[model samples]
Target: MMLSGLDHLLAAGLVVAVPLCGSWSQRVLERATAEGRPDARMRDYHLTMLTLWSLAGLTLLLWGSAGRPGSLLGLMFSDGMRVLIGAGATVLALLVLVSQWHGISRLDDAGREQLAAQVGSVLQLLPQTSREYRTFQALAVTAGICEEVLYRGFLLWYAAVFFGVWPAVILTALVFGVAHLYQGVAGVVKSAVVGLLFGALYAATDSLLWPILIHTAVDLQAGAIGWALRGARRGAV
Candidate 1:
């Protein structure tokens, strides 16, 4: 209710977009399965299409926020500020990854293989996989940009504008927790905890760049850990 201006617009875009995009993807996957061939390439194509449309949606959102031709609302913070956030994000990501790589409690050999196989399903190993990979890469990048802008960037602004700094931070974190409901129970719990953590970081720092960078690093680190465990299992075999 307190949200207004560009802050409101961004928060609204996120609240609307993710679920719509995900649901569209579910439909596409269902169609691919029903078609009988169900090639990975086909799935990849759908993902590409999905990403393109998402990009398009993002453009519209940006344009709407701009409300003027050839000139738009500039980022909430300075470029210098963004660079610092980016630096913090890099540090946070490395810290989390290295910690998890060495410290993430691993499953046994069987579990490693199972995890590997699960990763393989989304591997995109074929000719089309590369494109699909790029699509997903873009999707990840977009997520990093939009989610941070929306949640930590805009939402933080709203909370501070309507409430005080401390309440704003707490409320933003609460929204962060609620935002992950689509991730399922475990995901929801994890995301909520992490969301609040990230939210707090943003509030303290007042930059989305750091959160975006950290988010990407976290994903990559998790991916690497899974890859390492898989490699170890293969070596065992």
Candidate 2:
């Protein structure tokens, strides 16, 4: 209920970044609009109008984690485990890149069509999502940014700082897995795996920059594909 100075400081640091990241995302939209992208629908959420609120709550969580019995955060920062986890991540990513490459090169016409049908089937299972108006878009953007900082920045950092690199990675993955509890077991498992992948990337790269870059590229591709498909379906219908 009552937070001390360090708690306040950490919370302030984390919360402060949320708004900064959120605003930065909004500015990205503005810049895109300037270039004639004009995604009016994706620019309306007020809470996410280039800022968000999340400090006290996250601070408390981090503070609690600091005193926890086990801390993967602690482990991640250790001398040996850090390198091991980091190296593991890099190797996995390279393999993934290769697999993706092979997949693309190996697909034929019928294979592509069958893959398309499978993708369509999977899309049918996605929750009936709606378009985020320009307003919600900003908020969604804020959520994306803040959520990343909250989980990766603070939580993951905490685990690595307190636990051990390996422990931190595993603990963070568990936390990440739980975060997807709403998505069911499959979602949880997938998210957990992704969290591990991201954590490993962070460990290997020693910079959030690469993971963030990779995330941006992956998201952009997915977004573009979705947009193209939607437009094509609309035209056909």
| Top TM-score prediction, candidate number | 1
Query: What lDDT would candidate 2 get against the real structure?
Result: 0.49
Q: What TM-score, over all chains together, does every model reach?
A: 0.60, 0.47
Q: Candidate 1 residues 88-185, lDDT tens each?
A: 66686677677766644556776666665554433322222334445445555555665665566555655677787667767776666556444345
Across 86-180, the per-residue lDDT of candidate 2 in tens digits comes to: 55655665566557655744666565455444445222212112553223333434544454455565556655655667777677676766654
Candidate 1, residue 208: the lDDT equals 57
TM-score for candidate 1: 0.60
Which ten residues in a row are the worst by lDDT in model 2?
120-129
Each model's lDDT comes to: 0.55, 0.49
